[model samples]
Target: MKIKLNQLDILLEVAAQGSIGKAAKALHLTQPAISKTIQEMEAEIGMPILQRSSRGVTLNEYGQVLLRHARDIDRSLHQARDEIDNLLGKAMRQLRVGFTSAASYGPFTNTLIQFQARYPGVKLIVMEGRPQQIHDALENQRLDIAVITTANHTSQNSMYYESLYALSNTVIAGNQHPVTHTTSLKNLMDYPWLDWDEPGEHSILGQVFRRYNLPLPQNIIHCSSPWIMARMMEQTHAVSMWTSVRLRFPGYSPNLRPLVLREVLPASSIGILCPNIARLSTAGNTFMEMLRINTRDWLQDSDALEMVVRV
Candidate 1:
């Protein structure tokens, strides 16, 4: 009438791998040992958990219910182990951060450098993905903080957001692009345009074309990575909408030039999102403080530049 943690883990692994043999290889155990463990677990529960076929094994209804609870238990155990490790000074302080591609420019990089300088011993884990992916990681406790586009979410009670800045995206092309020489938005449409799109979110390219009352670009390239998009622009005549060019950052500037378009797309609000500030670890708080400082500096610098331009 007892089931072990390892047994539950094996079940989850089997489901993931879709076969007992594959799970055995992944868990570094023999196939017979894995079968024995499953048999013992099913015996204790007085029911069959998996339906076996020639190709693989699949979870039955009972197995599905047990697997859900097993995952929750596994997460709880991991949290407990982390807490104990920190209490005993056996583990280094760590902060897990996630950011959307747009948020990874300028101030975000500065904040990371500052945070590392401030806390040399703390470990920093960074992940870049779409807003939904970042939100999922934050909700699952996989990420301590996420910097993302301020999109509406249904899970308002589970997490909160703090605005970092509003980012204005512009159509950018390589310095050598023919479109770069022309001030006409009409001429730009002849070349391939890069688009960043997610399933439910609004398309950046669509907004620009709709604003100008121009038909969508004929040659459209769907890209996710900013670096890749930049490279494509550099090597080809491809163009993409980006915010980093405004900061004059070396990573994004010089290689890419903004085209003069008649339409202005609405700025997206970039923000720091977390489950709770009070629940943040020491390392997380330090990083958050660095981020706030960087944001302030960026705002001040931007204001100074605007004044100089006005003069």
Candidate 2:
């Protein structure tokens, strides 16, 4: 059988948990699938790895043998990989990261600029895509890391990732919108509110409106891109809600000033998104750490990120 290491990891978890249900829950797999794998392994080895009964399941004697050896195999393999990575040296390793279009041009670039200065050998491959695309690439193992907008309810429900850093608490309006002083969402609710996120209404704006017990305003302007939104704001009284990080972009001009929301809009977090799996290689790990540390410091000092733009 072409059993892979990931499958083996499942095997180990199932054995330790002593229950297929718990193992599946822990690994985010279906119960039957986990059971089938264990059974298939037993059949391939010509030994009962699990003793099943009404009470639950227990690993059999031969299963113990396999477990011990499997653990050693995993340890040795990991050590070998670490040694090889070390031998390759810093410059040889690669870092493939994906980011939202804005982040690809924004913080993602800043993080890399700093990473490059320290680890010049590391090659960076960057992609700009939608949030869904970013999630897909990471889940498919096509990307080592990504900067995604967690506003997608589907993504939040899937728990496909964990956070690295974020920018919370923001208010946004187009750069040239006539109404400039927007402290509370209530101020702009009656105006031409841009309906950028249409169908789901599950965006950060949705949560904010819902929390205040205010129905979403029907008057809408549906357009994507903060740049486009900014332009729309420039011509009309229309305004679009967005997080502060969107303004942090070098492209965001003094003209597009996002007034802080007074009713306390939900904080929007922008950060590095790692897949549910283990972290990347040593170089990737180092880069991720740099992101967390740097992002925290970046938000603290937006001036530093601006400096990256100048460089």
Candidate 3:
């Protein structure tokens, strides 16, 4: 069935607002107009798309499917506009990228500097979050690219993954902390733990504790932001698991040092994630190229090089 662009717009707005009246107000149309547009759309599809209630409206199964495709169409239209703007030498070129806290250590910052130098006219938007958050943003089209760490070298059907390097986690603490001198994992049980991952049986810290048959630390504080995690690590005696490369960065706190434990922690793969369906924008492609160039040397030495899966 054929659907007009305006009809798709009205449906999207109604779904977002959850009421015909609210959508009408937002779209600068009357409530009757919105209802009639939705009716026409339902007629075209031969089914009711929305379930109306006193509280508001909700999308039925067909409506939910339509909403998904409508969002994809909207994103495609935006991307097309951006590409045409770039080709016409417009100054509105923009690239949105997301990376996990661990991926921000060295190469990421360097690549950003180089990317900005090469594409000074392009507007850059960067976000830092956990891997799952970054993945969600990429899926929702909020971000064009993402840098994340995966322990199992997992693959997502809607995205392409390229391994940049392998990261090994280590126990770290303040310089003056008593645990810094400890060589055994068992000795660290008494100290509070600061972690970016959720505290549970599936977490990295939990897995580490299980590996040694040691009980997970009960006193755990979860902080997701890298900057805030660094500050907390500097001020508190709480121990944390951090990547070794981040500790080498000059901007990181000098007060925190890696603990020399007898047991070796597992390593994770850090990689680039891009949407599988859409082609990258000019700026996005340039930035991706710069990232590959910057990480070439590191990738050569990484054991996770074979973990790269471009599907």
Candidate 4:
């Protein structure tokens, strides 16, 4: 009933380090002291939290349940500290954001400029990753927000999802590539295909091939980094699919051109994903406000895709 914050910290450290001895060393306490803290925590909860093993200690079912709450508490405490720092005019306020490569195209960059202008005191940390990796970071409290593509407007319990722009997926190739002149998806199969490292038939190109009952491209090079993909597209005659929004960015490679295709590919929307339970800091809320304002026109133009199916 009277469990302390230090007790939860010990539990987390032990679980992270996987043994009492390691946790004790990491926390600058003796093994007995770490064991005593864990024992006190278990006594308060009236159950064994960790399972002992010959190799190492692991979290039992009870410990696993408590670990989730412990992490939540730790996140809440950090948020509280950040809020206080912002309120007291401290310069240590920081916001961590994760984004996919496509999400960094136009609107995201514009919002970052505006956010930095408004909140110069706050430090901004940005990371680019796959959609699933970004989502996992958001769930683990490692990131304050995420910008990524959402296939549909489905609801999630742990995170808030908002679709800002429904972008058309366009087939792109080097300007001198022979496939750029072809309008049919079947014709594209002749050349090497450049695509993301997504598994199975989940990619937009895969879906397009499946829609037309065409066999997937045999000569495929899968790369996860968009920058590297762009480089590969420019140097080689490989065809790839990318969002139209990415093409609008001023920094995009000039060697790449969107192919005018006869087949309509599915549309994916870019959006913001943030934790539902953790209230954003003042700086975080301000950045979101700036993002929402900057993307107002994009939301209205979401229906402006020329050769894409609205999904």
lDDT of each: 0.74, 0.66, 0.77, 0.76
Backbone clash tally (model 3):
0
- Over 4 Å off, model 4: 1-92, 153-158, 180-182, 250-253, 297-311
User: Which residue pairs collide in model 2, if any?
Assistant: 91-121, 166-270, 169-267, 175-256, 183-262
Candidate 2 lDDT by residue in tens digits, 235-254: 67776666545666666666
lDDT of 3 by residue, 176-247 (tens): 786645488787778888877796533678778888899878798887766676777788778888776667
Deviation from native of the Cα of residue 36 in model 2, angstroms: 13
- TM-score per prediction, in order, is 0.59, 0.64, 0.62, 0.63
Deviation of model 1 at 181, angstroms: 6.5
For candidate 3, the lDDT comes to 0.77
The clash count for each model shown is 0, 5, 0, 0
Scored by lDDT, the top model is: 3
How far is 28's C-alpha from truth in model 3 (Å)?
45
Candidate 2 TM-score, true structure as reference: 0.64
Model 2 spans > 4 angstroms off: 1-66, 73-93, 101-107, 117-122, 152-160, 174-187, 195-198, 251-253, 260-262, 296-311
Task: Kindly list the per-residue Cα lDDT of model 1 for residues 198-232, writing each as its tens digit.
Answer: 42345656766766788887888777777788788
Clashes of 2: 5
| lDDT comparison, 3 vs 4, better candidate | 3
Q: List runs of model 1 lying over 4 Å from the truth.
A: 1-92, 150-158, 180-190, 207-218, 246-252, 302-311
Sorted on lDDT, highest at the top, how do the candidates line up? 3, 4, 1, 2
